[model samples]
Target chain A: DAGITQSPRYKITETGRQVTLMCHQTWSHSYMFWYRQDLGHGLRLIYYSAAADITDKGEVPDGYVVSRSKTENFPLTLESATRSQTSVYFCASSENRLQETQYFGPGTRLLVL
Target chain B: LAKTTQPISMDSYEGQEVNITCSHNNIATNDYITWYQQFPSQGPRFIIQGYKTKVTNEVASLFIPADRKSSTLSLPRVSLSDTAVYYCLVAPPAGYGGSQGNLIFGKGTKLSVKP
Candidate 1:
């Protein structure tokens, strides 16, 4: 497809395990972001990359790691998964312009036991 | 960063006009108002954006006053398919290097359009 996609649409893991959610976009947008949607938190940003190799922490970046080696791919890794990390993860991309629109992926549902 | 406040939920009948307003009393000079719509289990989609006055697009219209304290998203003749959670966002000003705007989403107003 032409839009963004996240791999392993559903995942299950145990505590202390390492898991990664993959995000890839065809638009080659310079800005890629990862957000976790929980019951009351709405969408809390985990990490965002302005361009390849430049990533910044967002509101809830604890225990989550992100890297953007390529403009089209930004993978989010949980070093040590916990029960609190279970949420619907969404990946979004946008062009490098102020007030630009962000296109979101279908989201990855992760369940940590 | 500007904080936003909106109603928790609303209901309307099909073929009726719907307007959801957001209050941003502390909006900055360069802040822009934007609205997004999200269906259940789906990502939010951009509907409209405006800096001042009124800006209309195919899906919706955004009205902003001169003081920039608030904005309203108008959906004309909404249908059953228009039932979704509408988010009103206040974007950070430009000149900070085009990064991903940290969208502080308030509890969005869930509009249920009855058929």
Candidate 2:
């Protein structure tokens, strides 16, 4: 109900299908970020939003897209799901982009079948 | 952002104090060292942060030497529940086309506390 939350905690999709993972934060934080975590590695940033209507690419952002139309929302989209896209996606938010800790959501486990 | 190096894994006994060190030889003056703890199936949670010297909180302690090239995360009286991955990170100021919140999470130290 509060903090950051992600929708469809678990998702299943096939190749070539479009999928969207939703993230919401009640804190109205100024920054939101999307990350994907796969096996044998750490969390890699896919995209980040400094504020509403301002988003930037991170380490990995090829097949993923993100938008921040409102201060409390940032959603990630995959135009065409692929097996390699299957991973635990996490959404994070922070009051400001500088000198602050990023708070994370539980994560959305997507399985591309 | 400076590159960081840390142990791939560690083993410790329950009720023992555990310390995981990270090396960042190229750290900049504007960078701050931070640590995060993550359990399986969950996102990382911030443990402690330090600009230099040492910082402590209810969760853990962060020790940064004067050189700032290295830092250690100290976990006190660890228990089985403390077993998790610990990430060490450094971020430049937001002026460098990067926000402090835009952290780089490298392969963290997987700490296994045995009973």
Best by DockQ: 2
Q: What's the TM-score of each model vs. the native?
A: 0.93, 0.93
- State candidate 1's DockQ: 0.50
Model 2 spans with C-alpha error above 4 angstroms: B95-102
**Model 1 error, position B38 (Å):** 0.8
TM-score for predicted model 1 compared with the true structure: 0.93
Residue B91 miss distance in model 2 (angstroms): 1.9
Q: Write the per-residue lDDT of candidate 2 for residues B26-115, one digit (tens) a residue.
A: 888888888888998888898888999989999788999999999999999999999999988786655324443346776799999999
lDDT of each: 0.85, 0.86
Worst 10 residues of 2 chain A by lDDT: A93-102
Predicted model with the maximum lDDT: 2
Model 2 interface DockQ: 0.52
| Cα error of candidate 2 at position B14, Å | 1.4
CAPRI-style grade of the A/B interface in model 1: medium
How much is A107 displaced in model 1, in angstroms? 0.5
